[model samples]
Target chain A: MANILGTNIISSLGFTTEENFQTVKSGISGVKHYDAGTFGLPEAFMASLIDKEKLNDSFSELSIKNSYTGLEKAAILSVFDANKQANIDLSSGKVLFIFSSTKGNVHLLENAVSEQVCLWYSAKQISRFFGNRNTPVVVSNACISGACAQIAAIRALESRKYDNAIVVGADFLSKFIISGFQSFKALSPELCKPFDKDRKGLNLGEAAATVIFGKQNNSRIQLKRGAIRNDANHISAPSRTGEGSYRALKNILQNIDKGQIAFINAHGTATPYNDAMETQAIVRAGLADVPVNSLKAFFGHTLGAAGVLESIILMKALYGNLVLKSLNFSKQNFENKINISTENHFSDKKYFIKLLSGFGGINAALLFEKR
Target chain B: MNFKNSAELTELYRSLQIYYPKFFKMDNLSKLGFLAAEHIFNACTDLQSAPDCTPITSRREPVEPREDIAVICFNRSASLDIDTQYQKTIQDNDNYFPSPSLFVYTLPNIAAGEIAIRNKFLGETSFYVTEEFDAGQMVETVENAFSDTSINAVLLAWIECFERKVEVFMCLVDRNSKKSCIFTEENLKYLAINIKFA
Candidate 1:
């Protein structure tokens, strides 16, 4: 069994995981409408952005400022803070680092600097910052990248090839990414409302989150099941039936009991198809009534970071017996009868599942339990 | 092996007898992966008689849909072709239209998805971007994939493409194998750099 030793979040709300989670539990949204002129678009869009000035200050306090890109700075600072929390010797060879992001250092293309924008180059630099000797594995599999990384970390620890692994997922918004969503009309001009009848679309956010997985050490949380599958339905949109997500959910549910599941953290991107697909998958997996929450309204579909960031919140929720509300949700839009948590509830549940489906017809599900 | 280097990607696609027209739509990264994985399936099926058969095009060797197999790939440049294309649309003032087609391939794992679709692999797929084709790291990563207990086979690949520099390497890891190439870094390096995978 691989224990979740530590977790951290660096988002628009605050630096630490506690700050981000508590602020969201209170129902304060960081997403705000920004003028199109901010990014040279024709219309305004809502996004949750990290304060650049504050980020620079935090970086300098930890390591150095202006030496790394905003992307690298965020990644480094998250891992640094997480390492301090876990008290793990990152410099040792017994540790593995897996960085998950759809885009890493690709924003550098905006400037004329022309630095190498390769994912491996950035991964090497980031892993070396923590003195990790083994080559870092960089996963760039669309938004499910974080789920994929966690599964890898669990597998690595279980394989006995490494004693511990740090799985981090991060993505910073760029005009290129924003425009892609705009092209697809996927971005909601207002805060996204997940699983609601009036939901418009998803809102993108910037964040970097780290989760440390260690060998059995009496840790309270453990990663139990991880499964990734493709829809083979469509490149950008799967069939409305949620075939891939169902397969992933079913694969994870094979060894898990329905009663033991405390709650489910779903990837409710709030788009027309994404949420419908997830709810359908949940019902198909026979988890229609189990409490479900989507943190995208709080963190704004943080892309790659959504899986780990939201999982960390669920971990804390399981620990504190707090089932946070699915923010911005009012009515049910999905045909499946899922109990989307609209109000905060308290319970001592042992198990939780995280389900995430992304672009490229990919779906990933992870099962975790609180000891 | 019909294709030796990444430069032969275009010619390699032409040489293969695959019916999937989507092969023409993918970026160079996806093309490299589809073709490299094609080579591995060709070997696994032992389709030596299917003259110059790439994995995707060769139908002589019928293999069942194996959920036991996992896909793990490594590369330095993740989707540079599509990245360059998407960046081109946004970087300049005149040619600023972020085509969703190009934007979709911006992440490197789309290649893995293409292969999974063609092969019907429902297992876990991981795209690892590394500084280089470090065999030790690849070996370790492959072993970790097998630790899941349910995974008995793995489609290990190092399909890298950047600025016309193509280095496609794929190895099929069988958990029950007792051969000399028992999923080791040295053996991966050997198959990656020298000789066609038998």
Candidate 2:
């Protein structure tokens, strides 16, 4: 069994996991309109930007010269928390680092191309900062990279390849991401309303999340079974019948009792197709009655970081018995009858499943049981 | 599974051309994967009985709707477009003008995607980035693919494409067979020795 040593969150809403939970539990969202003139965001006003100055101050030596500053800070905090919780010396353990991000310091690359920077470093910069010289794996599988990285870490641990694996998913809002979303016509001008009948599209957000998985005697959570499957149906679109997601769900449900699963964190990107597809998958999994919530409304769509950030939030909820309300979810869609939590409902249940689907027909699902 | 030296590779390619002439003319990575896949396809012909004269493609058709046949491809080095991105970044004064064409090849799994697209094999595709080629990971990935009964075969390819040169080694694994053909340490040693003289 692999235990989550600890997790950290760095986003516009909160810097630490505790702060994020408090804000999300109270249904407080940090998504707002930006002047764009300040960051040269063009006409796009809405975004979730972390405090760069604060991040720089906290990680002075780490250097916040790029958009990955928040990600670096989040990684440090997560490792620190995990080290503290596990009470083990990381210097002695075999550290396998897996960095997940769709946009890896692309702003730095942009700046470098513009003659503002010197080099275009990859995601290895984060692992190098943590003194992890071992070959770090960079997973840039678009949006689902975060969850895919987690599943990869779990498999590596289970295979006895490494004693501990640090899985990090981080992505920040950039002109490239914004432009891509615009190209796809997937950005919402207004706040995102996941599962709501009137939901238009996803509101982009930025954040970095890190989770440490280790084999230990005392673990707060146990990663039971996980699966990564592809839809193979469409490259940029989700399956209309949710076959890929349903298969992934079925793979996870086969090992564990579906009724024991207390809460499900749906991918619910607030996009019509994604929400509808995930809803259908949930219903087909016979989890139609299970309480489900989407964190996109709280943090907007963090893209690559969505899976790890949401999983970390669910971990906190499982530890503290806190069920965060799904913000902006009012009315249900006709596709599924799942209970959408609009108010915080604490539960003592142990097992929670997190699901994510991304571009290229990649679908991944993970099950975490409280210890 | 063992590999041949340059001479052996030439022979293997010649042998493969007899069966798949179109694929043999492609890039080295494509040729390697095609060669390995042909071996597996030929091996599975007996168990999955069809007319002896039937073409391999006809026999390899998907029988089940949910059948899983994943391809996990790994490549460490950058593609030819890496130089293009670098040149653009240098010439344009560091403005983020990453060539979308180049960026698509930045990830290693695109090679597998190309193969899958060409073959019409709709299955799970994953790309893993490692500092160096790892036999353990290759075995693990093949094992994971085989663990699922639906996944009949996995096309495991390790390719490195850079400005200097391109090197690729690919093999196909099926759960039903215990025979080892390519990518084994013994084969690597044999190829290394042969290539040292070649």
Candidate 2 chain A weakest ten by summed lDDT:
A112-121
Q: Which stretches of candidate 1 lie above 4 Å from their native place?
A: A112-116, B1-11, B46-66, B178-181, B195-198
**Alpha carbon lDDT of each predicted model:** 0.80, 0.66
Task: For model 2, state the Cα shift of residue B82 in Å.
Answer: 8.9
Q: Which has the greatest TM-score?
A: 1
What is the Å distance of residue A242 in model 1 from its true position? Answer: 2.2
- Superposed by TM-score, candidate 2 places the C-alpha of residue B115 at a distance from the truth, in angstroms, of 5.4
Number of clashing pairs per prediction, in order: 1, 15
Clashing pairs in 1: B38-B55
Tell me the TM-score of each prediction against the true structure: 0.92, 0.80
In the range B48-139, model 2's lDDT, one tens digit per residue, is 21122222344345533333567777655423224335334323323534344344333334455445544545556676655456565556
